[model samples]
Target: MADVSDPLSLEWGGRPARGAPGPMLAALEPAAHRYRFQQGARRRSSVTYLDTVDRRLRKKGLSLRYESDSDSEVLVASAPDGIDTTELGEAPVWPALAEQLPAGSVADRVGPAMWVRAVAPVVETEVVSREITARNEDDKIVARLHWQEATANGSPTLARVSLDPLRGYAADAERIARLLADSGEFVVPERSLAEVWLRHAADDEVERRPTITAGMRADVAVATALLGFLDAIERNVAGTIDDVDTEFLHDLRVAVRRSRSVLKLTGDALPERLVARGARELKWLGDATTPTRDLDVYLLELDELATRLTVGTRADLDDFATHLHWERTVARRSLVRALQSKRFERWCESWRQSLTEIVSSGGSEQSGSVEELARDRVRVAYKRVLKRANAITPDCPGERVHSLRKRAKELRYLLEMFAPVCDRKPHRAVVKNLKRVQDILGAVQDGEVQSASLRVFAERMLDRRSASAATLLAMGELSAGFAGEQRQARDELTDALPGFLGSSVHKRVTAMLP
Candidate 1:
């Protein structure tokens, strides 16, 4: 990995006057046609060189050098804290420039004919590292690099770039070659390049301005924090099972769920693979903790409700509690087995790999407008919630519905997160409708849980033979009442969903988000 703490300068290419090719052109022609400019503080100085290498002729390696375009010579550095070629990729520097290409010109022609120069002050560098271990039958090396650098001044000047194959040279070589060839003819306008670099310079000044919305800051902060948190969780899971602290594990599970929910609710601003893998890990963690958590909840409820029962009912409750204890014991054992399972270990490994890809893909650094990203995330979340709601099974336990309700809440929260940047009225309306859906689901789940508890008590009394005919009759009546409540709750939930979604308010909200 390049040192990010030193100052650096990078200069790429520009068309020389028609009369003669300049020294810079002479330096660049032998190398790849594309060039990159980077300059800034220690960690912030460097230009990314994507697809600059030709793989077909590996024996002959190509490297970039800066030449004097007019007066000054292009400078390159390898400071422990300076600029390096770790950030470039195949994505066009100026996407809109492509549209401005001349007839028959492969590259887009836009902006200034003058030279391109880009510079920024370094803020930070994120590094991901791993060790290679010999397994039963496989010898593999693992390495990853993902980083974000912000300008010295707190501005929206953060750039995330993925380092090319840090381990597999052959694979990376081939990939880079293919990317360059496939990019066709591409040209970047000097003005656009200058604009991007200038944005970094103005970052500090912008931070001082009051017009900069708090919502934008919050969104960036949350997204950055999430990336770091997920990285930590992935590392812990991959390296050692013992490292998985209960609280940390639980929090990671929640974070994954929350991030996914937020992403879905807002619309997928991030990459799909990251969101999908995070959701998968969340599900795995949920499953791993389910038995213990479920038993814990059941026991708490049993203890609380037992005290409120009449003496005869108490007896029934006691028998039910005993059965629950037995079930809990069984569940605990099952949970332990699962935690130690080879499958679990493999799942963790897979998750770590997926997370590595997401972190290193430079997906976070793409050029889309932030507002567009946020709106997309909200839309995605809404769709996910709707799909989950529609998929609810009658046979699923009350706990399932409770989980779904929680998901709905997350989606609502995400929509609210985007309300400021995008239109809020529609999001507000969607939230209102979503709240109705959540309330109905909540009621249904509550009724189901209560009814299940009552059934457990009834079965226990029948098994123990401790109750008289009168006691049995009373228990039967209680069970019948609980069942009625459960049915009513379900009916309400079913009847209310369409209205909640179809209302004019919901339609308005959907329009806003979309």
Candidate 2:
């Protein structure tokens, strides 16, 4: 973990002697049978350079050596770690790494005595690296360069400076500077950035407005992604607690939420409620993961704050940090135990079975056509909206109204999805009404989130018994402001509901649905 960002003694140009392959080759050949598990190793170090694209001071090229133990081949890059990885995944530059190897050569023999060779194909490796360097205008060391490369063959590789190690830190700074100067200008197009979003959007459209040809394809894609997410969560829960990270947890939660949301919106179109139940299970999983996620967020913020505290406040900060760490440890332990509980495990199995059943069930229900199912969902949501609207008493708080607003929005999204096949004017009118409700409720929800966040911060500060009087006063002021805003938003929502729900536009939209 020591930062490999500084220039290490460079060694290269090693070649394999003409000879028969050894036992390592036999061991690696099986990996080739799997199509993506070729074995290789690399050592890299960097110095200082300017990151031309970011227009910032960055780690420069140091040295990297890749060797295939099975093939006795090597590849070396006198480039920034990021660029070196990028080249492997993308097209080669002039005098490219590819040219350095023999035609059909699987590896490069490089350096004095041909001692090093890059074993993996340039197109099959992913590269991720990061380094810490001094700011261009300040002496302060800060984390700067970070890059991730995912290659065509689905193999991932990562390299990062070990900032906590003193030597690694100095080398990281030197590597950044050297990399900028030595590496040639090579740019990867930004188009790939849209792939995930576009893929999801297309799936959403097909789910919302399925064509005969696209229906099965879209469903399978969505289902597959959902399964992947579920599997990751299951692994995280059943595995060691130390393996969990904030980003991983967040990604898992999002996958679950999106899958549930999509299923809730379109499940009636399927032959059974299996998908619906699966969605409910996902919601349960999300709820189970919430405490650990909240603690993760708190720990991150605490770490950030700790770095900025003065020496005089060190004792108090240490005490608070210890308390937070204890809390996180307990939460993680509880989460792991809960995940292993028979009740939770049974639910997970059932959920997975439901998904498998739905995917296997080939035929659609009577109401399976996209238009019909969309209308049904819209009407169902509308009924809930009406019920909530009717129950809204003057005494109801903003939180309740905000919940209603979400229900209204769901109804509106469904209607809009089917608008192409339905009466557009009526659908648009309903959407407008829904928007009005959403706006009012959204304001209230924002206030609620801010207020809750402030309250949590205040409680943490108080628990540490180190909060300043000024901070306490500010928290009180924030709470009062949020309360006032929440009240105003709730009143606005209530006052608008009568006209909004009873309007001629609303009635017309409801009439057109069925």
Q: What is the lDDT of residue 132 in candidate 1?
A: 16
Taking all chains together, the TM-score of candidate 2 against the true structure is 0.45
User: TM-score for each prediction?
Assistant: 0.40, 0.45
Best by TM-score: 2
Root-mean-square deviation of candidate 2 = 16.8
Clash totals, every prediction: 21, 46
True-vs-predicted CA distance for residue 483, candidate 1, Å: 2.0
Candidate 1 lDDT over 113-181, as tens digits, reads 201211112222121111111111122322122223323233343322222334444353233334332
The lDDT of model 2 is 0.48
lDDT of 2 at 147: 29
Q: Pick by lDDT: which candidate is best?
A: 2
